[model samples]
Target: MIDSHIHADTRPFEDFELMAVSGIEGALTCAHDPLEMTSFDVVMAHFRRLLTVDPERAARNGLKLHIALGIHPRAIPHDPERVIEKLPDLLRNPSVVAVGEVGLESGSEIEMDVFKVQLKVADELGYPVIVHTPRRRKAEITSQIMDLIDGTMDESMVVIEHVNRDVLPELVETECMLGLTVQPEKLTPEGAVEILREYGTDRFVLNSDMSSAPSDPLSVPRTVQRMKMEGFSRRDIRQVSDGNIRDLLKISQI
Candidate 1:
């Protein structure tokens, strides 16, 4: 199984071992704003960690780590154009899979402008994107995000993350995939299973969204176990836990 979204740089090395031992084969670590104040140099340094430090650490612990680079909404630097210009070249790296963990946080004008610029970059590069929806004003902001994605790029190339039941219906009709995050303050294992049953497993993918905050590194495997207890078929389990994300990111099975 692959964790579709995670901030591996924020996790302890032991967590990777636990995830690997729990049957998680790979994970995609996305760039996020971890500090109170972010600068262009800081963002570039974080990207370097995602590319160089994090992958090697995960590999040593037995998990294959993939990277997704972008300026997260909350992490937007003073001069975003510099970061945007660097993305095309940075995204060409073999380990980087998408432009992600980017989208509306406060829904400010600057946030929207930066989000659109990153979306355009991803669209032109033909890379998948992992968009974020905040806990507060989720419905309203997600609606705006959907609107931005409508004609801007291929909806199929985007996966909106941290989605809950309230916003699930809005995304169902769209071509983008739904990211069901199982973690503290997000969906529980039981809730995730319930969603799979109601929504079916075609366009859904499971993730832990593990990061500096409280999270469960083995959330995906634990969710799989819940699905089994509920009598979900093996194929259905594979589709959500592994296949859907692999198909979206074009990652190989480990």
Candidate 2:
């Protein structure tokens, strides 16, 4: 299991064959705000279909897709620095990892100057970022996205996704990486296992931001069968449904 946020190009290839028959091997699929960003070649043809047509339609319906390109502060276009100078040659595409569904929905000022220029281009290309936090003044826009990711980048390479429980006690004492997005309007596989039993699964990551709204493509294998009917360990449900997002996107094992 690894859904650390999904879109699979707005769902439907039978929901990646029902999220690979409900055991969901892998997924990432980020880059958002597409109902026309309107230029920079329509956001570089939607980041070249999330690097070539949504990883060949999630590997022909057996899942294992992964990619994360940026620009999603409500899909800002009209020359977002030419898609931030073409995101380091398409994030050195080896099925691109992160820079993500970037941050701040309406903390405007050009969405905080395009989320501080894509978090300074994912901290000058070291990569790993997925920061989206908005559902109307979510803890004051996540404290202005943790003050533009305080001192810029390396809050353990960022991940602050669609979290809840009113910003989980200030993002569980930040060092980033916490996504918990089960969707329906977010957070409800028993409120993402009650924020992993009151925020214990350190650096939590579990997702199904499966877009085109009203989602639940087997929301991370039905929240891993509700963390196995709430008895929770199996190494804490394999570290939030797959080893803290495959060790925060260093994803090696296929």
Candidate 3:
């Protein structure tokens, strides 16, 4: 299973720790382009300025760590374009998977502008967008994104993050996939179940979304277990596990 979103802000456990603990094959390590990776150095076992993970390290640990480039919302105020301009090169690497953790937020004016620029970049580069929709404006921001991508993107070319309650119908109508973070946070497990019931496990996906939160690393396994206990079918559980995520990321399973 792949954690569609994650931040490597820790030092004691590197990015693969999630897969190691979950007994899953891999996870996507969201490397924030704007934050000081050093500030959160204490959590990871080690910090490498790796845009794409080192295969040797990942193989040694029995996991695959896929990295993506994005400047998260909080760090958007920094010269985001300066940081963003480097993304295409990062995406050029065979291991770099996608182009976000991008999109609008009502957090700040800088956040909005920076997100706009990043959205445009993600559109231009043709990498799948990992969007964090605006607070309380899921419909509004999502509508705008739909309009923006209507003519340009293939509709399946973006991934909407479930940072909060999803506007599931709107997300589905937009022909995009929803990324549900099923980490160990309170309310997350239950919340994910609800979305799965509403959207089902196909277009919906499960991610750890773990960065600074005390959420469990084995979030996907926990999700799979809880989902089954909640009466979700094996096929549905498999969708949350790797089917939907691998499809959205276009990773080959065979």
Estimate, for each residue in 70-126, the C-alpha lDDT of model 2 and write its tens digit: 888888887888888878888987889898888988888988888888888889888
In model 3, the runs with Cα more than 4 Å from the true position are: 14-18, 33-48, 52-58, 107-109, 134-152, 163-166, 184-186
What's the distance in Å from true for residue 143, model 1?
0.4
State the lDDT at 153 in candidate 2: 82
Please provide, for model 1 over 139-202, each residue's C-alpha lDDT reduced to its tens digit, 9 standing for 90 to 100. 9999999988888889999999998989988899899899999997789999999999999999
Give each model's clash number: 0, 0, 9
- Model 3: how far residue 179 lies from native, Å: 1.0
Per-candidate TM-score against the hidden true structure: 0.98, 0.36, 0.79
Error of 1 at 131 (Å): 0.4
Clashing pairs in 2: none
Q: Which candidate is the best by lDDT?
A: 1
